[model samples]
Target: MSNIVLKRWKRTEGVVNESYTHSDGHHDQSTQLSEVTLTGHLGREAQSPIEMTKSAGEAASNGGDDSHLPNTLTEDNRNEGEAGGGVSPCCNWSWMVVLGATLLMCCILSAFRCMGMAEVVEVTVAWGEVDPTFVLLRCRQLLTNIISSCFGIIFSPFLLQLHTSSTTITIIYSVLQFMWNSSGLFVGPLVEEFNWRKVAMVSSFLSSCSFILSAFATSPWQLLLSFSILGGFCYGLMTSLSYLIIPHYFTRWRGVANACVVAGIGIGQMIGPILVEFLQKEYGYVGGTLLMGAVLFHACIGASLLRPIQNQTITNTSVQLVEPESRTSGVVTAEKKWTTVAIRIFLCVCRNIVTNFSVLKSRRAVIIAIGGLLTFNSWLNFIALIPFAVQAAGHPLQAASTCVIVSAVCNLVTCLAVSMLSDWSKFSMKGACMTSTAVIAASTFAFSVVTDIWWQKIIMGMWGCGVGSYMGIYGLTIAYYMGVHSLDATLGVTQLLIGLGFITIGPIIGVIRDASDSYTFSIWVLAGLAACSFILWIFMPNTTQHSHTTPLSPIT
Candidate 1:
């Protein structure tokens, strides 16, 4: 028979209590970091509105029984270590797994663009027909990607608070993979069907596969369609999920953990294309395809490792409602933590805008807007402009593709350095934003003047580095600002503008390069934007100083 008792708890006031079971007749003896078992809902203990604050955090961990209430095991009620073992091993893996998966997600995200926008430029130069209308194709692909991302994120809020197993995430991932597998056959049919979600899923899967087999497709259409479907849609959603997966499992170091999450996409961006390019040349497109699909399979299987503690949805059931400070007169505690968080986050951003009218009145919104603006440059230029950047520097097709490899590596290194340092030094997270903006501005300015191949590598890689760092901190910023509860919606609100930034500027990037006979002006325009980021950074408050005073144990 299973019994429930509070084994241990980290009361927010700052103390930890442990209850270890003394073996009687040889039952297992053990200690839990915090109450992983949720007997009821979260609100049961709220004595005041201030009780509305987030529960004391737990160990930064994942893998528990979602089938039951989270706090089933209490400190006073220690589980016997058990003969066959009751706890699952999946949740015990370090945060590094999430980081590795995220990096691949980033690479898959850019894979499609790398193929059509980046690779085609190379393909055409090497062998044959180039679309004079490449600019038009570039715009279409980018717009589709942005729109898909916007909608994909729209559904994310619901999923963010829900406890899904790696199994659930993997199933979704597999459906996405099917999309890619079908892309070669269903390209025209997909356009006709008009079911964007299915098409989007299929596309996302294919894009992930592309990273596994980067050099498989031989034609312009193959590269374009694969990227548009797989890289744009498939990779995009999976990357988004990387954010959701974290809060469900780990609460401590949420921001730092998120940095690694963001870093995943960065690493993927770094690795995806290089592997594809190498495999494609070494084996043929078929061999390249198989290799990439296999890598994606590995990632998909890894996603399966995540499981819901208690094995039940936290929401459908009830939580014990405490009289939270945010509550009115008499309120019962028994709501999902998410229900309250959603309300708190939306209000926070809106209130900050109202109370800090100075932040609102000035270009702070624009500075915030700049973050969205920068997101557009990564895949957009990689697809349309970087190839040109490569050609302009006088490299051959294969060698020019190496430029992306360089850009990827630099992005990974810089983001890791920035994130790890920020977490260790406890620097303000904004320090990262400032650092990225500074590097981007300096690099873009230098890129505008440099024409030598080696110089191009340095400058372009620097630009990519800035983008990667920003991506690394993307969710962490929201986590820091609105707290983890507002993460999805804040991302939603921020990304709408970000999507616009991509939509608005992608064409101009192409047009400027087309009209000027030189990329000098375009690089400068981006450089100026990067500088504006720095100016905005000046007005932003420092986050490193935020107090980390909560009791360091799992919420009982």
Candidate 2:
């Protein structure tokens, strides 16, 4: 009888295990039997053994380790686990690190805007024997914008101290800017391939060296070599890396993240002039430049904090896996001559360009790019001319600097507020952008006609708001329509296109300043451009309904 009872029990256990496996796909017979035995202990729980078995199977399938399986088998714990595994919030520590570092970079770059060519031109005229002509000054400004916008500021106070002609300085500056901004194209691929921290380290070293070397330069060519070429290249590397890093740490609040990073420029603008002014007074330009080098070295710390996200997309994984194959194949064909290698590289670049052009096929993308080009051109033109306009109005250097300070402060506040609003509110990005463009146009026109310092301050604040609004919204707008994955390539293409405006507008403004002996005509022209940008935005599709609540997918 005892043997008969043991056989019956064994048969019953086999039936329960088979039923559990059939009901749930989890084939872990041991785990299911343990759960069934535990449920049987609670006499009432025996009635729901199947339900318990299903929950256990789910917990196991979800990749819960043996230790966590029992606790997370509950519905609430499973839901919590899912929420925790999703994209991290913006306020997390990792994101904070990215934000802090980006802000510092912005502050550093902002110094360039404050170190305006207008001030440099005045110093050249006052201290040097030969005054640089309007054309020469214009060329210098253009070159500065092109090569290293930051170095233009860093070296301007000292450029007049060199024994080179203004024309020579202009040429060197342009070469440097060209090297710096264009370097972004080359660095973008490396950044995508290797670790960004390595890029940041190299950039910091180059930038620091550029500043320290600039302090000892005595000729135009030397300045170009030290500050323009080397410094410009490094700056481009850092700039591209910064943009790429922010996207990795954010998705839901990307607009806010970008705004925070951009707001650092305002911080730098407000403080840079004061810092440089004080340093120049006590240490001279050479000593001040050396000090600037020390400050730039800290950027490496920020770069070091960047950790790669573990949840990489399948496309990224596949590319990484194929990289070794490509490298191995290249080694196998190492007998190829240099010319063949060069041709292959050129063809590869052409292919990439062709791939990137796919974005232009979309009407919405084209509209955004065009509007971005116009808005970017208008804002940069206004910034480049602000000090000149103020000085033209017969204001003191201090007053002009104060105008920059006020605008910078306003820009900082507006950038943060606008980004937050876009993330939280129901307002349409298109309408907001159009309204901001109109404000920019009107404020620029007002700046041209108004001479009173008080009114000029008001207009500068207004201009700052408009600029902040457009910049704050533009990135989010692109992400909304095209998706976040397209942002880097799209931005890169847009930058290249707008560079044409940068090269052409400065010369035109220079010609106008030379002909009219004032910035009135140039300011009006910029205002008109801003108005045109506003009109372009009007035709842009309304994206209010698809705001922050929607999940973004690649635009393929």
| Per-candidate TM-score against the hidden true structure | 0.54, 0.69
Residue pairs with clashing backbones, model 2: 146-177, 147-176, 147-177
lDDT of 2 by residue, 192-226 (tens): 32345566777877887887898898777887888
Clashes of each: 76, 3
Model 2 quality (TM-score): 0.69
For residues 38-101, what per-residue lDDT tens digits would candidate 1 score against the true structure? 2222221211100111211221121121111122112211223232122212234335445544
Stretches of candidate 2 exceeding 4 Å from the true structure: 1-97, 103-107, 110-154, 184-187, 277-287, 309-354, 391-398, 543-556
Please list the Cα RMSD from the true structure of every candidate, rounded to 1 decimal place.
Answer: 15.8, 15.5
- Please state the error at residue 447 of candidate 2 in Å: 2.4
